[model samples]
Target: MSWQYVLELIQNILISQTGIPHMTWGHGIMLLIALFFLYLAVAKGFEPLLLLPIGFGIFLVNFPIVPLMGLNAEGHMNLIEYFYQYGVASEIIPCVIFLGLGAMTDFGPLIANPKMLIIGAGAQLGVFVTYVGVLFFGFTLKEAASVGIIGGADGPTTIYLTAKLAPHLLGANALAAYSYMAMVPLIQPPIMRLMTTPEQRRIKMRQLRPVSAREKLLFPLIGCALIVLLIPMVAPLMGMFMFGNFMRESMMVKRLSDTAQNSLMNIVTIFLGLSVGATMQAEVFLNWKPLLIFGFGLLDFVVCTFGGILTVHIMNLFLKEKINPLIGSAGVSAVPMSARVSHVEGLKADPNNWLMMHAMAPNLAGVIGSAAAAGMMIAMFQ
Candidate 1:
């Protein structure tokens, strides 16, 4: 009860809590950055589903080394690190997301116009371009491959490929991919406008033929066979994606398809986000490499968007029918988001313009294209 006792107790507590003393100004900076992302996810509604968990993970992992991300003094992986290992490092979470995506997607649009496949492949120019560009920055081929995938704008593919080729850079690549995806509406529009005139944006094509259920069911089988045969490395993600689509098209496993689309997808997304965020410790994330990755990511997106539009122009030169160039911008794998951006831009050019279904073709194809790109990256390292 004496003053001496109180002072001694306070000294003991401060000495025991290592995190309190070991914390540096860098920790504060990272924490603030995490808070800003939280604001974007919560208040600004920027990819809230992933950003919210990712922001919290960043906050938790940077708190002066409290056994969150890596091996402890006992030489065992910590809790969050386990999630990163089993869920992402093992490539389970990304494949699960693809399964959900396949269940939700309708291949009708891409099926009706098989040419959209080429546009999706064209958009991958950003991936290859950035891959070669990052090598000039002294990155290893594997590291550059991981970084280049940010151009694809497919977070799962980015995570999957980075985990295989450059696990260390997974945090930056995932963040860049998701950030650009969330900003698709903003990053794509100016590029779309600059690449194509108002007349090109307003161009309309004839209505697409309605695809039959039999065709939908057959498409997944054929797609799976061809894609897997070409890129055996893509079997995990692509196989799951095709299986999910088959489930939806089959109409026989409605309950399983529902679970894949809704319940399982929701669960994996939370774990995936947190694991990704946990990788962003101050020591690892606050570096020149991450900064460079961000720069390249922006360039990748701009170039990819440009490539898609350019492909459309080239195709129009040879075809009897002209398609709206805006749909080409959907070739980045942001799913309906990139597609929706193209649709909104089309509407702005001409209110009567409806490009949603048309844009879905390239949007859907981008998913496959990105997966194939990821497989190629994995093959390079293997």
Candidate 2:
């Protein structure tokens, strides 16, 4: 090797030679996205439990060539592949999270007032509507289904379906769904306020008929079996969800149930959030599709809210009971938040209207209704 030849070889290796591959500028842009997500998760208080970890994961993956998430000799990412193999692929995380949800949830409100179940079901119209909308926008049938369910604003179902139908969109879709859920307060009230009159909001209903403990214990299992028989694909989500509730109400496996309700479930959520977040990197993430999907997600949430209120008015034509329309808003199953929003709105309408307990029926029904809707999507798409 002559000195001149050696110098030329070193220069060729150090700099980009003609037609050789090099890192693109996409990565730099992705880093900025990571920071933005982090800011939203932290200072903005946007689904912080899920988003904070996800933002950290995005930052970690884009830091050049760490391969913290990359494949093994078998050609799969250590974290993603492992979870898919054991976490998502096994269909464990969704079920595990359901256990936590079931343990934490109360069914008295829902069972006491069954008609609110209709509101929850009505809210789910957005899920299917968005599915059709996404397809019109050029996403494939499966991709559209995955994107549309983000509107349902149910985190586990979002993850469950995306993992089965649109794995590539998993990170973006999960992030969008949870983020939109956190934004419910900001996104909902204006639309809800406009849709109803102050007088309509002031309409109060009778107190809920109290539900028995036995009815509470029976509802989950019976609902699970009936729903699963109707749509088997959602079994992973619905079955485990009901099973968890059954476990909690059964009062038999205190240790096992407690583990599922608390420690085991919490640990899995942290892993699921981080692992999902890690999948986002600039090289793979910079595009118009995710932004469009996110916009559609917002539209879906708004439509679902409207659907609930509209249903109440339509039903009012037939039913004599003067149910507060605010309770209908809680039918989206945002759990405590959506329920609380109904309470707040009712208080604003009239200081005497204590719609929280009454709203609880619709709020709890929203959980089952959302799960059933999620199950339907899974069956249709899967």
Candidate 3:
């Protein structure tokens, strides 16, 4: 071959094999966004477990001509696409994550104070309200439902519902849910303080009654039955959750429980995060819809926090022993983080006032409430 022909062949090889020739402004922006997420996860310690894998996935898939999130020439699904299709789109990973959460959860606080269930349900006010609000902004019923559930602060439920109803919006919804969840410490405290007085924050609750092992073991069965009867659409997610909890409470299957809580959970989490982040391809994510979702998500969370505190004030009018309004903010299903925020806020108000156990009642209740709300929406739309 002539030297000129060889030079042209080498240039063709570089263009085909490297992303540089195919890169666009969109890819550049997405890469920078991925790096920002990585920095947050690594340096700022913001939801490191999920954000790290998600950020990496975003980085990998954004490279032009990469097979990470698409089908190959032979039509075989690429790596992240396989994970997205089978694990996330098929609605398996989120339920599996719930199983792990159930395995690690302690339901004693919720069982001891069943009334906290109202606060949990109350916190979902934003879900329905935002549902109505978003429809005015031109989102369809399914998309609005998916967006509204972000208020619950339950990442798995958000993923689960969005995958079922509006799979196109999954990445934005999941990111919004987790981002707000990670910021629970910052987002919730101010609302809690503004909603309650010093005396209300200082209100000390009585110690929860001791729970018998029999009660613990029976709870999952009873809770599952009631939830399924009420909203059968949620059977898959709730079934796995209660089954995992049953295994934990039984003490007869310690190995299974441990595996669910640690190994299986971690494995599913990696796939889930990566799959989610891969969906944020610049063309899909950098749009007005995702921006609106993010905006409504923050409003939904704020209103949910406000609703929870408001519910407490209303309940106290009839409650013989008043609850600390601060615990109401824990009614969003960020789990122990929101509960701890309540405890810390209480401690600030009264150094001797301990609210962790009490806050847990509403926190755990929020998990159930959010799942139930997801079930309700599925039933309505599906």
Candidate 4:
């Protein structure tokens, strides 16, 4: 081959074999977005466990021709696609995550104060409201349902519902849910303060009654039966959750509970984050729908927080004793984080006032309520 022929051959190889020549503005924008998420995960410590892997997955799939997210020439799924198919698309990973969550959860506070269940239901106001609001914005019933659950602040439920109803919107919905969950400390306090008075914040709740071991063990069985009988569509998620909790409460299955809470949970979370992030490839994710989903997600969360506090005010009007309205914000179910925010805000209002245990009642109730809401929507659509 002559010099010109050799050079032409080299150029052809470079163009065909490498991703650089095919990179587009969309890929660059996705890369920047991925890096921003990485910064939030690493430097800012926002949901780092999920965000780190998710950010990295975004970085990996945005390259022009990475063999990571789609199918290969033989038609088998690529690496992340396997995770997505079996784990997310099959709706297994989210339910597994719920099992882990249940294993780690304590229902004592909710059991001691069953009235807190109403706060959990009340917190769902935003879910239904957003569902209606998004319809006017052109989201279909299924898509709106998937988007609205972000208010619940339950990442797995968001993923589960989105995967079931609107798999196309999974990346946007999951990121929105987890992003808000990580920012619960930032988002909830202002709403809490704005909705409650100084006296309301200072309202001290009596300590919860100590629940018996039998009661704790029986709760999961009874709760699971009631929820499943009422909303069988949620059986996979709720059943696993209650089963995990049952194992924990049994005290006879320490090994199984520990594995579910720690090892099993961690393993699935990695797959879940990566699978979700990979779905955000430039061609798929850089769109108007995702932006709308993000906006609606924030509104939903705020309204849910507002609804929770309002529920408390309504309850206090009827109760002889008062509830600290700060705990109402914890009804969004960001777990101990939202509950802790309530506790901290309570301390700011009254140094001696402790609302952690009280806040936990609605916090845990929000978990169940969110799931029930998801079940309701699934039933309606299916």
lDDT of each: 0.92, 0.79, 0.94, 0.94
Kindly list the per-residue Cα lDDT of model 3 for residues 1-382, writing each as its tens digit: 8999999999999998888999999999999989998998899898888888889888888989999888999999999999999999999999999999999998999999999999999999999889998999999999999999999999999999999999999989998898888899999999998999998999999999999999999999999999999899999999999999999999999999999999999999999999999999988888789889989999999989988899999999999999999999999999999999999999999999999999999999999999999999999986
Which tens-of-lDDT digit does each residue in 253-298 have in candidate 2?
Answer: 8787888878988788887877787777776677878888888888
**CA shift at 22, candidate 1, in angstroms?**
1.4
Local lDDT at 56 for model 3? 89
- TM-scores, in order shown? 0.97, 0.91, 0.98, 0.98
296 in model 2: Cα distance from truth in Å?
0.4
| Every model: Cα RMSD to truth | 1.6, 3.3, 0.9, 0.9
Error of 1 at 240 (Å): 0.7
Query: Where is model 2 more than 4 Å wrong at Cα?
Result: 1-24, 73-77
> Candidate 4: where is the Cα deviation over 4 Å?
none
| Residue pairs with clashing backbones, model 4 | none
- Stretches of candidate 3 exceeding 4 Å from the true structure: none
Question: Cα lDDT of model 4 overall?
Answer: 0.94
Where is the poorest 10-residue window by lDDT in model 2? 15-24
Task: Count clashes in each candidate, considering only residues at least 3 apart in sequence or on different chains.
Answer: 0, 2, 0, 0
lDDT of 1 by residue, 1-382 (tens): 9999999999887867667887888899889989988999999999999989999999898888588788988999999989999999999999999999889889999999999998999899999999999999999999999998899999989999998888889888888888888999999999999999989999987789999999999999999999999999999999999999999999999999999999999999999999999998888788899989999999999999988889999999999899899999999989999999999999999999999999999998899998999999898788
